[model samples]
Structures are given as C-alpha cells and as structure tokens.
Target: MKLVGKTAIVTGASKGIGYAIADHLMTHGADVVITARNEAELATAAKQLTEAHTADKTKAIPVAADVSLAADITRLFERAVEELGPIAILVNNAGNSTLDLVENLPETDFDAVVGTHLKGTYLGTKAAINHMKATGTPGVVVNLGSVETFGTTRGNAHYSAAKAGIDKFTEVTALEAGRHGIRINAVAPGAVETPMGQDATTPEFTAAWHRTFSVERMGRPADIAKAVVFLASDYAEWITGITLLVDGGTHLRGLPDYADFLLPTTN
Candidate 1:
C-alpha cells in the first residue's frame, strides 16, 4: 500500500474519471474525501469506495462541492483534514467542457467550463500547498489535463485553453513548491470514454480518435487512474513538474476533427 496512512482530497469524484481515481486511491490505502456538485451522487460514490475497498468507512468522506467556487474548494480541503487527517495528496480532477465553436460558444458556457478547470485546479493546488507547508510534510498533487492542450480541439477552444493552462500551472507550481516538499504534476489523458469524453465518443468519433493511437481500444478511466496512483506514491519521489500522458501514444498523433460534433450545420 504505497499510500497507506495518507489522506487525500479528490475533486469531481461523483462519477467518471474522478470516481475511478478516488476508488483507486482508497484501495491503495489513502483516506480520501470525494467531492462533486451533486451531494447524493457524491455520497453514493463515497459509500461505494468505502464499502468496496476499506474496512474503515471513515477512509472515505463525501463532500458536495462546485470546484469552480472558491468557498466550496476551501471547505473541501479543510474538511479532508478535519475529518481524516492532514492532506497528503490532492487530485484536481474536476472539469467539464462545452461542444461549441469559438464563434458559437456562449460567454456563460465558456466561463463555466474555463472556471471549473483552470480556476478550480489553481484553487486546489493552493489549498494542497498550504496544508503541506503548514505541516512540513511531503505532498503530492495530480491535476487532470488533456492531450487537447498540445493537440487541437477545433470548436472547443475554452476546454483546450483551460487544460493547457493546467499544464502550465502544474509546471510552475511544481517549481515553486518543490522546495517545500510538495510534488505537483499533471496527467494528460487522450480521448478517454468518460462523461467528459462523451461528446466525442460516437462511432465516427471513435474511429477518428482511434487513428491517433496504436492502441485499438478506447481509453478507460482505470487506465488513467493507475498512472495517478503511481505518481502520487513514493515510487515517483524523483518525478515532478511534468505531465505523465496516459494517452496510449495518442499525443504523438494529430487530433481528430471536432467540428462535426461541436458545430451546428447551417443552410
């Protein structure tokens, strides 16, 4: 158990990639506080993780939070420590995207998507660093990024910007926090079949996405989770400031056309 006796906060853990990450952390012996906007779903997710993976139900706590909001994120970080222990790891796994081209993208929709991913990740990073520095304990942070940061995601500029911002945020923060015994990194996933990837998971889209990778099958949440686990563990003590891409070699290839899904055809 690489993470045994550690405590962590995993945002956006209600479903999809976030849930898988939370489950993986707890199973590997971390006390985790899972958060999402939906309280019921968050509760269910926490219950599922504890019941299935831990003898101690206290190992997992469900907190309802909208990571876009500073208040909610602050509460989540504090609660993790108050309920479990000092924060040892944080997975900034909360973010969503819109299916709209730059011209058609609504301002509100753009704000919502960008705020949740970029601002949210920043807030979580600050919180993690605060706790780590205060306690003088080594800490790990894993921010969720996308291959779209390097590759193009036509008609999805906001999502791409936010994820790209996350990569830069992870890098600079790692540089600043490394001296404080904190390791910050990002995981850039490629075309995973998660709720976030639902917009681009059509048969046509799948074929297009598949062409970017040597791997024949679509990516899975578990695939990303394994990478996060390894990064969060002492096994990666020497690793920091880089994004570990669990992209099945897809990042090396060009991105598929997102216009067909994100843009509306006009007469």
Candidate 2:
C-alpha cells in the first residue's frame, strides 16, 4: 500500500479521476508528474497537491502537453524523469468525447477520441517502458478504459471502439512487458460523476444508469482512483492484463432502457 520512493506520471490529471489518482499517489509517498492539455488547470492542480500534502514527503511536477502528439508524449516522459526521477507508475487517463450517429460521425471526431485514448495510451506506455527496462525497475501501467468496451454506447461508436481496443492492447502489451517485470492493466469505469459525467447525466441518462447500477447512485471519481491505486501497487504484483470494471455492476445488467426517462412527465 506504500509507494514510498516511487515516481509516477498521471495524464489528464488536472481534474476528475486523474487528479484523484495523482493525489492518492502523493498520499502514499510517491512523487508525481501531473500532465494535461490545459496549462492553467495543470498548474493549479499541481500547486494544490503540493500545498495540501506539504508534510507527506511528496513533490508534484506539472507538465502541460497533448498526449496525442508524439512530440508531446516524448517531452512529457523526458520532463517527468528529469523532474521526478525514473517513473515506476503511469496512469494513462487522457481522453475526449463525442457522440453522433454513424451516418453523421465525422472522421475528425473519430481521430480526436481515438488518438487521445488509444494512441495516447500506447505512446505513453511505450515511452515509459524504455526507461523502466533500462533501470530494471518493475513498473505498472493503469489504463483508464470504459465499460463501453463491453456494452453498447449509443451515439459514441468511436469511444466504444477505442475502449475495446484498449482492452486487447492491455493484454497483448502486458504479455510482452511481463518478461521485463512490468504489469499493465485497465480500469473501465461506469458513469462517473466527473465534469464529463455531469454533462452526460441528462434525465434520460441518469435513469438508465440507475437501472444498470444497483448502487442507486452514479460512480465517483475516487472509486476509480482507488481501483487504479490497487492495480498500480504491489498488492497486485501477480496481476496483469486484466480490465477491472469499476462501473458498479453496470456490465452485469447491460444498458438499461432510457425511453421512459427521456419522456417528459406531466405533473
């Protein structure tokens, strides 16, 4: 449970589950590199973590970069190592969202979401592995996948496809990295109450979510964060290539009917 003397990198860490992961790592005695596309948010998040966890013996490094770009990914890892030392943990959480019918889906939308989630995760894992191999340090990579990987996500075909790709990528990559003492896994969350989740939680969405999750409420970012920490910690030393769904049993019941919820009620 203790990550003392470890250095980690968490992308998309300015808010939501990524921010929680960075904060949790800092709490467990790990120096962290927090990256996001928004420079202002990244700065603020880094400052907040540093300020709140002053006596935890943790340091926060903020780097603003679009992980979809190879150059930015390169600079991200380089700067992370320079600032926090060799990275032992990596959480690939950078993502984008767009929903449209297949007939109306644009190539740009597909590229944006796929590039950020799939490509970003791949590049980050590749770059980190090079350093981990050189140092002979066993590393862990926790990919932020989604429950859409298994269920149908109407209007978000690109996102669903990208998450499905991550599931397979995690397995194949873990097999290769296992020889080098590296572990890679994924945490596929359900309807988390983040900015993204809030935007998606229309009356139609919330009711559908409730039907799927017996828990009565939508998942929280910290729920996913706790799972990420366990998968990244030594507690899961023998675990790899598994995608744990943190969606409060949504995949068990499948996507629920939203037609009733979408209909306006007249009181």
- Looking at candidate 1, the ten consecutive residues that score lowest on lDDT are 258-267
Q: Write the per-residue lDDT of candidate 2 for residues 1-267, one digit (tens) a residue.
A: 999999999999999989999989988889999999999989999999999889997978999999899999999988988887888999999888876766778999999999999999999999888889998889999998998887874577888899999999999999999999999999999888898667645866677688888676888889998899999999999999999999888988897532333323311
Candidate 2: segments with Cα more than 4 A from true spot: 256-267
Task: Give TM per candidate.
Answer: 0.95, 0.95
Q: After superposition, how far is residue 93 of candidate 1 from its true place, in Å?
A: 0.4
Model 2 Cα shift for residue 235 (angstroms): 0.5
For model 1, how does the per-residue alpha-carbon lDDT over 1-267 read when each residue is reduced to its tens digit? Answer: 468889988888888999899888887888889998989888888888888874644467998999888898888877877898789999999988777777778999999999999999988899889889999879999999998887886788899999999999999999999999899999999878887677545677788888889676778999999899999998999999999888888877888878864453821
Clashes of each: 0, 0
Pairs with steric clashes in candidate 1: none
Model 2: lDDT equals: 0.88
Task: Work out candidate 2's RMSD over C-alphas.
Answer: 3.0
Q: Candidate 1: lDDT of 260? A: 67
